[model samples]
Target: MHGWLTTPPGPGPHPVVLIIHGGPFAQVTVAVSDETQVLVDAGYAVLACNPRGSAGYGQAHGRVIRRRLGTVDRSDVLDFLAGALADAPKLDAGRLGLMGGSYGGFLAAWLTAHDQRFTAAIVERAFLDPETFLGTSDVGDFFVEEYLGPSRALRNAQSPQELVDRVSTPTLLIHSEQDLRCPLSQAERYYFALKRGGVAAELAIFPGEDHELSRGGTPRHRLQRLELILDWWDRYLPVRPAPHART
Candidate 1:
């Protein structure tokens, strides 16, 4: 339920991006994030939040999302953003972007599907379909069963792909071809569904990379990833020009 918001200089109401962290079980601490810096430099405010399911908040908080992937954790993220916006008048509520990797991407996809507040979203290395994840991912079977239960029906209920039909925001899917933790098929399936449903969507697959591409991929690939993300935001949720700079 805690997070950090980094804003660009001379912000009078800058577009904001809610950046979620991977490992629904991991905690996001205050640190120098290269992506956050990149976004801020491009005139976007970045809000990195650690919700209920995140670690370092005691065992009970982290376990609350067990068998409830998109429930409380989803609410915590939106609620946190609401509170953040209310407190920071310099952040525009209309132009909001969402991006996350892995479990974070799951929540981002889940939220944009149900909530129409986001101007755009980037889903990277997401665990989208629980049923397919059970066999494809290195930890799929245990992770899905443990977090979503073993029932096929229950798993489908929490799967983000099931709700893809409802998404209206333009979305970008970024994935690694060799990701064993969340196979490339996850992004492909969602991309196909999104396009068929008439939503603005694009999928970018990086070769020779895995699930850890964002954290451990080669420097060149990582730079490319950053450029891709920035380009997506620029197209869909562009930063408004400052009043003084307006022609």
Candidate 2:
């Protein structure tokens, strides 16, 4: 229910991208990501939502988000769209986009599967299978125990893998080859499902990098990856009235 919004300069009917930050407990808004500013500068409206589960809002909301996961947070997203965009007359509803990494990615994939409101999505190093996560990720057991309770069945019920077969939006999956936390296989499996479902999906695996790539990396590579994301949005989720000026 709490977040920030950014606008592109000299814009009318600009596209909007919903930025979902990672962490079952981390406050994405406080952690800070250059992508938010960059995307805003690129002439798109940005709605950064720190929903119920986010840490900054307090402990209670965080616990609530963890317990319900998709059920509550998904509705939060829907409400966000209703309240946040209602004031922006230039916002393009048909071109709505979702971008998230790690936990955010899972949410994005979940939204893609549960709803058709989004036209495009960018998922980075997303976790798909909680059962597999317990095997592959170093911190999986901790999160599973901390957030979703101790039940294995409860964990699977919240995982994106369980629902990816239903996703229809065009999605771009990006993960680092060196990502030990989420692993490349995670993205691969989701990408496979997207393709199998006859959905438009593309996977980008960054070599010699880890989960930290999105947070900080060589300037050139960082810009390159960011550009690839923007390009993907432009290609598939272009606004009805394209901005007249683009660098």
Candidate 3:
């Protein structure tokens, strides 16, 4: 596991936001982005990483999680976060948040259910139910076959919907109504299950937007999305003001 960590200036112990990259085979570089800067500026430490099954780490590492969607990748992320917290004493492990889109969004939901350490989560364009997703998504069959193989039971077991009842972390779901890749129904089903399970969850839908909502949506909507994320984190894992400013 490889990652980049950025801390806010003059911080003693800061809340941490773990940003997971989208593709199950993609890599997260050390580059800084406006989105990450926003969190850093607001006094949150941001940690972005490339876990196992991510590209740029050779073919063996990238293919290690094949046919095992939620198992190895999930453990890799958890281990990476734990190691990061251990290395950085200024990071507050108790006030942890997770943010990601697409495949990463799926992991966010998976982690929220399997782990109790995360205080909040921002899930964008997530794939919640493998059964439903196989029918609705444009790339459903290919995605399922490529990553999960042909086992129906295995797919259901790995889907986020199956574990929604265990999620207690406050979650904010951002989905694009016109998204054909993952589809909006993914978000709807997850939100419904979360509500039914008594979990703190909210869903935000962007009209006329697709899977590219975060990367190439209208400028106004992108800004709105960032604001929504910030608001969610503030509501759940708020960054306390500096001592000098408090007085």
lDDT of each: 0.92, 0.81, 0.89
User: Per-residue CA lDDT of candidate 3, range 1-247, in tens?
Assistant: 6888999997559999998888888888866588899999999999988888899989999898887878888888888899999989999988899989999999999999898888889999998888888888999988987787788988877888988999998899999999999999999999999889888889999999999988899999999999999999988888983357553
Model 2 vs. true fold: TM: 0.91
Say which prediction, candidate 1 or candidate 3, comes out ahead on TM-score.
1
Alpha-carbon TM-score of each model against the true structure:
0.96, 0.91, 0.95
Give the runs in model 1 whose Cα sits over 4 Å from its true position: 241-247
Residues forming the 10-long window of minimal summed lDDT in candidate 3 = 238-247
Q: Which residue pairs show collisions in model 1?
A: none
Ranking by lDDT: 1, 3, 2
Where is model 2 more than 4 Å wrong at Cα? 28-33, 239-247
| Candidate 3 regions with alpha-carbon error over 4 angstroms | 241-247
